[model samples]
Target: MATRDDGAGAWYHRGQVCCTNRKLDEALACYDKALELSPDNPLLWRRKGFALIKAGRYAEATVCFDRALAIDPDDATAWQRRGYALACMGRKEGAVACFDQALARDPEHILAWQSRGWLLGTLCRYDEAAACYETVLRIDPDRGSAAWHRERMRERRDLAALASEVREAERFMEVPACIREVVRERDYGNAELARAVLREMVGQAERPAVQHR
Candidate 1:
């Protein structure tokens, strides 16, 4: 760690202060000065990236995150910020992948989970999105905003799951009449019945069609 006795540390501290004041440009300048003194410092690069992000220079922020990741591949926050930059650029697939990487590196990252939930919702993965919000609520129940998002997403997920079940039921009706009779007559569980039909259907599909005489 750089100490206050060093010029770079002094500049970095200045950068932090500027960032706290939302003076992003000044913060970037301070970080740039710090980087000039300590070129390989990943924290300086990451902080500069944050300033660039706040300034709406997402492309620059992305590059900064890349540099930070190169310096330390396990930097979860850098991965998360990279995802944020990609998302802001409308590159959702890349953003989601980055967020997944961030989570794989640090599952306890609440902002990463929250952001992933928002991205998953945008991608129409409502159930998965709801799961992410649910995790966020578990991590910080006192956050009313997170609680609200979780409740709404949970409702959507439940509705989606119900609709999925309805569709599966309709599909089940199209199966062999004999299979339906067995299912209706026997006290077999619905899950086992579905598995039985699936096995039969798969076996039939894998076998060659019988030739007509």
Candidate 2:
């Protein structure tokens, strides 16, 4: 029979060592043994959740985070881990909510902020996503990835606006009633010229209302 640790200290030390050695399964087992002895220890549960995540058991990791959060609702680390696990599981909304909770607890939490930005980007909230990336840049000026993401978000916004303009141009090109008779009666000397005139008219009509600054 595997004996459980009566004191949380020994189990925590062993678990940390196992984790440091990259033996995630053994680390998780040690954490489990610790939790079995002290079910109310939020830190132990949080450690277990992290080890489970390292083991690629994201859903189970989320459950362990939930257990830790239930024990101490103000645990920001648990909330952050839960958010990461949710994001890994493709639950963007849930991940956003969890990240929000983590940020509420610790406003300076960089990972939570970055995660929120990523989730916002995933949801097509480009402006908000850009804001989040900017926040990260403010905290760490050398954050190259955040800068790259911010640029991509700006490009996506510009591209979406351009695409909308193109669609509007297509809609405007539907043969106008006033031009229908003229188009039917007049034969241009060159097919290319007729197509060029039509394209010019469509472009004029579909000019986007907003100008990019």
Candidate 3:
């Protein structure tokens, strides 16, 4: 494997480091540099879009995700992010459509399932929301929050708030442990899940990749 430590790969990996450190502006710059070297790389666009999402630039993020999908239409991550961007923009229907498309491409996508479930619940579509939660439970029974989602559905919370929460949780999962803890103080999280997420993030960051996690 060609590690990002070598050649043009350096830029991408550095960008990932910046992202992990929550330096989104710097991360975007690094990604842009890498894109200059590898214009066709969908992962670069996806990662850049992720940074844009964190920065609350939903429109720009959606454009980046669109570029990613253009290069690889079946990329479920891009589709999921497109959905997230739409949700951030308060476009509920479009967000749901994008989430549905993501799930279609990757039925096992846990985040997509959760997102769709939460959205459906907010819209008073209890049956569909329950179905989504059921899918999530079937896929990962160990998900402790699965049960709470049903309760959440009953509460009929704001979809926008739910969207923000999901996005924050996801971003938290991507951050380095040191920074994650700091961010966690202000965000809701489970200790075990955070540890698990940190492990995954660390593992991915340490892997040899010309792109990034």
lDDT (Cα atoms) of all candidates against the true structure: 0.80, 0.79, 0.78
What residue pairs are clashing in model 2?
none
lDDT of 2 by residue, 1-213 (tens): 344545666788899999989998889888877887888889999999998888889999999999999999999889989999999899888999999999899887888888888888888888889988898999998999999988777666544444444455556466444334333443222323444555677767556633432
lDDT of 1 by residue, 107-137 (tens): 9899899889888878768778888988887
Model 2 worst lDDT run, 10 consecutive residues: 182-191
lDDT of 3 by residue, 39-123 (tens): 7889989999999999899999999999999999999989999998888898989999999999999999999998888777767
TM-score of predicted model 3?
0.69
Q: Candidate 1, after superposition: displacement of residue 197 in Å? A: 30
In model 3, the worst 10-residue window by lDDT is 154-163
Query: Clashes in each model (backbone N, CA, C under 3 Å)?
Result: 0, 0, 0
Sort all candidates by lDDT, best to worst.
1, 2, 3
User: Candidates ranked by TM-score, best first?
Assistant: 2, 1, 3
The Cα RMSD of model 2 versus the native structure comes to 10.5
The positional error of residue 94 in candidate 1, measured at the CA in angstroms, is: 0.8
Q: What TM-score do all the candidates reach, one by one?
A: 0.70, 0.74, 0.69
